[model samples]
Target: MPSLRIMPKVMTLTDAAAARVSALIAQKPGVKALKIGVKKGGCAGMEYTMTWAEEIGKFDEIIEEKGAVVLIDPAAMMYLLGTEMDYKTDKLSSQFVFNNPNQKSACGCGESVNLEPATPPGFAPAEA
Candidate 1:
């Protein structure tokens, strides 16, 4: 017998993002899911990172929706809360974009962002 447990979701994806991710998995050999996180660097001090995840790590938060699977780095859970990942293309270029409410500011080049951890809905922050 198996037990069912409801887990909290740490992130979400746009329809375009989900479809794009699904296609990437199909094209890559031996790929499992897409791994995403934030790293320190870039002009804004933090850069969002995405890569091909061949296996799930021990503490990665797994989100599966719209025929796609994403492995979110545990360390990035706070910073990425309430974020919607999307895919965009234009005549100039194409890329994946993060629409994040917790993002405090971004650099001029749009390559990095300084993010503040997201606050839960209906919760007010305490004042000093």
Candidate 2:
């Protein structure tokens, strides 16, 4: 029999991020997780999109840490690989932040980013 290979997780969450997400889940009843993706239109060419996921999608990659659950859109998986999710708070505001290795650049205001697709180790593209 062929050996089974387990796919690696796309991203990870920090303690503060997990706690914040857990709190958000508690406030909204019946929501499964926070869905994350990338979109076009930002000055940097790409922007992150997040929403409450009521149910899991067939291709969604799920990450659960410290009681916080997050869903990664399949289309954005490559762009988000090796990213770390964090929550930050200051006197003026609080927000979730993404530290992504594949990011090339971000807009001046930090509203968007430019990213390159990441290929997993040992992965090879199919012949055209």
What lDDT score is found at residue 34 in candidate 2?
96
RMSD from true fold, candidate 1: 3.5
Please give, for residues 15-121, the per-residue lDDT of candidate 2 as tens digits.
99999999998999999899999988689999999999999999999999999999999999999999999999999989999999989999999999998888788
Per residue, candidate 1 scores C-alpha lDDT tens digits across 20-108 of 99999999999999999999988888999999999999999899989999999999998898888999999999899999887989999
Pairs that collide, model 1: none
Model 1 poorest 10 in a row by lDDT: 119-128
Return the lDDT, model 2, position 16: 99
Evaluated with TM-score, which candidate comes out highest?
A: 2
Native-referenced Cα lDDT, model 1: 0.90
Residue 126 in candidate 2 has what lDDT? 41
Candidate 1 Cα outliers beyond 4 Å, as residue runs: 1-8, 121-128
| CA lDDT of each prediction against the hidden true structure | 0.90, 0.93
